[model samples]
Target: MNVMAKAEKKISSAFIYFFGSFGGILFGYDIGVMTGALPFLQADWHLENAASLVGWITSAVMFGAIFGGALAGQLSDKFGRRKMILMSAIVFVVFSVLSGVSPDMGEASAYYLIIVRMLLGLAVGAASALVPAYMSEMAPAKARGRLSGLNQTMIVSGMLLSYVVDFLLKDLPGEWAWRLMLGLAAVPALILFLGVLRLPESPRFLLRKGDEAQARKVLSYIRKNPAEIDQELASIKETAKEERQANQKTSWSSLFSGKYRYLVIAGVGVAAFQQFQGANAIFYYIPLIVQKATGQAASSNLMWPIVQGVILVVGSLVYMWIADKFNRRTLLMVGGAVMGLSFILPAVINWMMPNMNPMTIVVFLCIYVAFYSFTWAPLTWVLVGEIFPLAIRGRASGLASSFNWIGSWLVGLIFPIMTASMPQEAVFAIFGIICILGVIFVKTCVPETRGHTLEEIEEQGTNHGRVKASNPEN
Candidate 1:
């Protein structure tokens, strides 16, 4: 009987991790699907000369995400994380189908498609903000980093799947290929919605809502020993009580208060830098970069994204192994240095030998992707999940995620224009500089959050700030 119970508990735990991070699959799929679809869309719609429209088409989703992230944070605070995830899945399914079936009526069709993609972006942004927080709240403190890192793993997996799907469907006649690529997102969205239906509400969220009985019940399924469960519940209740006494409303204004100012800077700064380092330029526009480098047709370059996707998945596996073992700050510093060198080397190589093989740039890009997958991509989510106080975590994470999407939107909107006006090497040099700055930010500002409970981290952040202010000499 005890053996049967242990097996059931293990299965339940696995189920939670799988479904909890499924939103990331949708996030990665939407982002990667565009990389493959854009080439075909350009050819079909006669957008070769329309750099502005192409940029808008690619970035419209990110713009929509800026709003979605803010709104989902507020909604998840009130309606619960599980409901918000369900809402995001529904949004993904409806808009994905709409994006696929957009009327091919010339420039008008491009405008219509932008509108649909923005709606899809709304879902992606919400999932980005909500999933990590949900997973962090539900996971054990010891395993939180690994479980939260699963979101990144699923994200890369989704990207890999989308790339493979695009490669397989590249030969389809007319616009159906891009349409299928865009519409296929509905499959995973549906799966997420159904999977989340069986999941319980987050215990921390339940405790915050003054439902101790339900919180304990939920904790029982996730926690192993009853003693540990009670201890955690007591800690949560105490945190909730303090939050109530503080009477701090969760809002943008609250995030900027003296107490949370530094944390806000660290979280939002890291989130923005993750995008500004130009990884998305590779993920979203790699084929275009390849087309410029090798002078090859975009259709022939589908395999390149698959190669990068493999590297992303492999790097994420490495991250899972070390995430809980090392200080988050230490990993970011090492990753930032490697990532900076990767970008800088490519620019230097191109400058020294302008006519070098395009594969050289591809090799550097693969290196950049490898370092970034384990570091900024996964760790950013982990920090955002771990750094914020419980009182402001949902809204603060939303704001941080908004900054991330905003940076992504800027990169997606401007990269084609930059490439059109300047050398690709110059463009990458700019990102290399940003990567160096990212390393500095990690060293000076970001906190170490390995192996700490969310509540404990919050207290330490608050008290440390107080101590620093009181003892400026230290």
Candidate 2:
């Protein structure tokens, strides 16, 4: 009986991990698909109208992402994670298809493009918030970091797959090529939408709704044995009850209340720093940056993002392996410092060797991306997912994710203008500064939550000054 129980537990864990990561896969595809497609899009649409147009076009989804993140918590709580995911998947697929097939530069096409991208942004934002939260909820304490890290890994893998498709299709030399690249997202979105249909609702979510029977059924599906399911449920229920007692009301202001203030600050601050770290600026414009640096053709530029994507995927895997082994604080510092250094070297190369071989700069950029993937890309998700309690997990994660997208939107909006107006070297140097600040913030403010249970995080979280002793807000 014990032997069979162990096998069943392992299988259940594997299933959760795979599916949890799939959510990130959608995120990755959404992010990377645009890089290659953008160059073609710019040319196809004759997008030289004004900087505002360019900014609007690029930042449109980001703008939508802000609201999407905000909506994730409320919707996930009201509608459930599985249902929201299904709905978002449909939105993602529909928008992806629309984004690809919208007519060229006509009023209708332009309007449709913005609308579709906005919808896509909503899907991306919601997924970013819910995927990690869902993954963390499903994962056991022992394996939570690794499984949640799967979201980041899938995100990178999606980026890689998108880049690969971009490369393969870059030679088609028509608007349809970009369309095809964007439309390809439909395949994964559809697969995920259908795959998750059979998966159980989150046990924690079920428990929250006072549906113990449903929660038990979910636990049974996720665990191998009925006995193990019973044990886990008891533990989870106890934890949930404690969380409910700690605070039952979910609100934006509640996050700023006595007990959860510091956590809110930490969560939101880290999320903001993540984007301010200049990751998206690089991601959004890397292909263009590569083309400028390497003096390469579009096809060649397309290949570099694919290479970068591959490096990011590998980096995420390596980071996942080490995340729980080392302190979260230590890893963040290391990653920030390394990424900071990566940006500096590239800036220096561009400045001192402006006339030197372009390949040298490209090589350094690749190294920078490789380092980023290993550190910030995956670690951020793991940290965010594990740092909050069950009661506030949805709202807190949503708010934090909102900050992340806001940062992304700002960077995406400004990168073109910054790169166009300022020297490229200066632009990168600014990112380096942000990365250094991130390192300092982690060292000073961030707490180590390595290997802690959700219950433990809630207890420690209150100690960080996020919770108040007197007034009740949420």
Candidate 3:
């Protein structure tokens, strides 16, 4: 009986990992597709090259994302996690296809493309909030961090997949190459949407929504003993009831009240800095950065991003092991400082020896990616899962993640213009500066969540505890 119970628990967890990681697939595909697609898309569509227009074409999704993240909490609360995921898949399919087909502004298809990207943004925002929340809820206390990290791992994998495909297809000599690249996203989106059809609704959402039977069934799939399932369900229901009685309603003011206020500030800052740390500038505009550093032709530059993506995938696993061993706050600071130093090295090398060996620049960039993949990539998601209580997790995480994506959008939209207008050396220097400041902010403000349970982390923040108690598991 005990062994069978363990097997069931393992299968349930595996289910969560597979479904949860699909969310990362969407994230990676969108992120990876745009980087290589943008320059060619802009050229092929004959779009106006205005900075603001470029920003719109690139970052317009943030606008819809702002709404998507803001509303995801309420909608998930009202509708169900599975429903919203299905909606996200539908949105992905619709907009991704449109983005590929959009003609220039004067053409009738121009506005349609913009609208689709904006819609895609909403899906990004919603999935960002929902997937992690769902995973956190489904995972056992012992495995939460690793399962949640799976989402980030999949995202980087997706990014790598995109880069490899783009490299393979770049020389096809037809505008359709980019379209096919963007359209490939629809395949996974459909599989994800269909997968959602079979996934059990999140037990937390079910319990919170007062669907006790469904919650019991779902809990049964995870917790083998009826007694354990009953106890857990009771605790969740009581927590849900107390949460409703305490708040009565969700509001913008809820973000600023008591302990939540500090969390809100910290959460938003973490999300913003995750992007502001200048990771996207590398991911979205690596070819441009590589071109500036190497003065290489366009064809030669396509391979650099693929190398970076591969390094990132390998780096994230090492970082995940570290995340389990060290204090998250310290890890974040060290990562920020490392990235800051990495950025400076390249900028200085480029300034001092513009014609330096391309291999040297590549080595520096690979180091930067190594630092980013292990620290910023997975830890950011871990913190988001740890910081908020179940009651406010959806809304708070949504808003924080939305801000992060918006920051990514801003960098992506502006990098081309910044590179064109500002010296590459200065821009890289500015990125280094931001990373340094991020180190300071994280060191002082972010809490260490390495071994603590999500509920414990919330209680620590609520009670204003100076430090989290060490986890026995660690």
Q: How many pairs of residues collide in each model? A: 0, 8, 0
Regions more than 4 Å wrong, model 3: 1-13, 46-52, 104-111, 249-251, 257-261, 358-360, 389-395, 452-474
Model 3 — TM-score against the truth? 0.88
Weakest lDDT window of 10 consecutive positions for candidate 1: 4-13
C-alpha root-mean-square deviation, each candidate: 3.6, 4.7, 5.5
Any residue pairs clashing in model 3, and if so which? none
Ranking by TM-score: 1, 2, 3
Cα lDDT of model 1 by residue, 291-344, tens digit: 988899987799988998999999999998887687888889999888898888
* Each prediction's whole-model lDDT (CA): 0.87, 0.76, 0.75
* Candidate 2 per-residue lDDT over residues 390-460, each given as its tens digit: 77776787777878888888888888887778767678888888889999988876777776776787788
TM-score of each: 0.91, 0.88, 0.88
Candidates by lDDT, descending order: 1, 2, 3
Q: Supply candidate 1's per-residue lDDT for 234.
A: 87
